[model samples]
Target: LEDEAAYDRIASYSPYDNITAKPYPAILAMGGLSDPRVTYWEPAKWIARLRDVASAGPFLCRINMDAGHGGSSGRYKRLEEVALVQAFAIWAVERSAA
Candidate 1:
């Protein structure tokens, strides 16, 4: 009985339940296929839900098929992901400005 309230409170904050009609900023939902902690499906599902609910979209999913939750294990490979994020930020800014 005590946990019921907690469950309800937590459920109230769940993204799936709280989708609003308001416009949302561009979202980059990146994940790794081998990720055990934050599985790839989470991002995929989020992107799908956002597409369905949001008024507009620039939602993107970048999944690394060979990596895990921490992303690429090497320095150079990691930079590639970083670059993608930076590029996305720039693109979003340019898009919003225009």
Candidate 2:
């Protein structure tokens, strides 16, 4: 991504950079409080920006206090987090369709 054209192309993939007047679909942003790869605030910031810029939103932030980037350390807890994400996805899809 060092080359100017290559970097521009790569950067174009970010949703945050492409925000427009919405009726944009719901956004579920999940982040780990202790994530080493993606800090919790990154999602928070994106959601915040969406809320500010988009015309309408059901944008959500789910910050797992007991987990990191990979989610809960325990198997059951991890499953629960997965279920929550799946449920959210379904709900978002349903809302978008309605």
Candidate 3:
């Protein structure tokens, strides 16, 4: 019961519901298209909302078409995902500083 109530209450605080008309830092959202844990639409919809409510943030959504919740199967492939995230973080920082 508490969890259910929390869920209901969270809607008011949700990013989707509480989007402000202010500029925000850039976002890097990545997900797997075939992810069962978190469907691809989750990030896609969030990105759309961010674009609509806040035009200042540069939102980048990367969906791995052939991957699922765990992402790439191999160790090296997983590293690639990490690298991408690192690269994005660096890019965002540099862009913000400039």
Candidate 4:
């Protein structure tokens, strides 16, 4: 699938070694437990990979168990998405100051 290929390519180019390296920009990875196109495992695995490399960037992964796909659905659980975005904004602002 295109998603898997894209992720594979990114992982190939991603620096998964060397801590103390230049800090990457904030990474906000979110997944919906019911999403059929992309599994939650993808983000979780990527987070683990980044941690293994000891990345210096802000990496946050969140999952919405009651949601499906990526959207702002009023009928589904969306608090996690909103919280993640807010947190990312704050994090980016603080990091930019440093």
lDDT of each: 0.86, 0.85, 0.87, 0.70
In lDDT terms, how accurate is model 4?
0.70
How would you order the candidates by lDDT, starting with the best? 3, 1, 2, 4
Q: Runs in model 4 with CA error above 4 Å?
A: 1-22, 75-80
On the 0 to 100 scale, the lDDT of residue 93 in model 4 is: 82
User: TM-score for all predictions?
Assistant: 0.87, 0.82, 0.84, 0.64
lDDT of 1 by residue, 1-98 (tens): 47998989998998767878778888888999999998889889888888888966688888999899898879999998899899999988888888
lDDT of 3 by residue, 18-93 (tens): 8788998999878898899989999888899999888788987899997899887688998998898899899989
Best prediction by TM-score: 1
User: In angstroms, how far off is 3's CA in candidate 2?
Assistant: 5.0
Regions of candidate 2 where Cα sits further than 4 Å from its true position: 1-3
- Look at candidate 3 and give me any clashing residue pairs: none
Backbone clashes in model 1, listed as residue pairs: none
lDDT of 2: 0.85
RMSD of each: 1.9, 2.1, 2.4, 5.3
Candidate 2 C-alpha lDDT tens digits along 9-43: 87789777877766667888999999999999999
Q: Work out candidate 2's RMSD over C-alphas.
A: 2.1
Is 3 or 4 the stronger prediction by TM-score?
Answer: 3
